[model samples]
Target: MNDAIHSSKAPEPVGLYPHARRVGNLLFLSGVGPRQRGSRDIPGVTLNAQGEIVDYDIATQCRSVFDNVRNILEECGSSWERLVDVTVFLTNMKADFKTYNAIYADYFRDNQPARTTVEVLSLPTPIAIELKCIATID
Candidate 1:
């Protein structure tokens, strides 16, 4: 059976899904964006009235996305060291990979988890990046 885990420290899910779910010892995190918890504001993003991205800083968005993921990890009784895999989505891979990779390295450092980064046309929100992770509790 699957169990949902919600973190009060993270932003409310923009969609119907819960923040993360666990099946046995493995926890699967939903795609987490850069939205702030109370304000719902996306850091480093500037959107037009139509909700299209005008300007964005991938570094800022990257940090917030990871922060959200970290919050989920903590709330789920896991830790960064427990992360087994990570999948990252970026709206602009060519333009943003360097900065995002740098910040990511800072976080993971020597305990790097298996990772994949992909470029997408857009996300549900106007943010530049999102992260999904799988971690083990035992």
Candidate 2:
């Protein structure tokens, strides 16, 4: 059976969904963005009052997204080292991949979870990066 999980320490989801779900020994996380909890502010992103992203810094967005993912992982009694797989979304592959990869390496340096990075037209939020992952709780 699977059960949903939420974290007070992480950014609330933009849609109707929990931050993570547990089934057996694995926890699956929803797409975690760079938005801050309560404030809903997206780091590394400069948005117009209309909520359109005018500019962004990939490294900053990547770090914030990772922190959100970490919060969900820790809440599930897991950690970075426990991550088994991850799917990353980026708005600008040509411009952002280099910085994003370098910052990502700093987080999963030793753990080395299987990862796939894809260029998406856009994310649900104005942020430039997001990550959804699965980790073994065992």
Per-candidate TM-score against the hidden true structure: 0.94, 0.97
- Collision pairs in model 1: none
Candidate 2: clashing pairs of residues: none
Displacement of residue 102 (Cα, Å) in model 2 is 0.7
Stretches of candidate 2 exceeding 4 Å from the true structure: none
lDDT of 2 at 73: 92
Candidate 2 residue-wise lDDT, 65-95, digit = tens: 8988988899889998899999999888999
Candidate 1 residue lDDT tens string, 57-123:
8888888888888888999899888999999998888999999999999999967899999999988
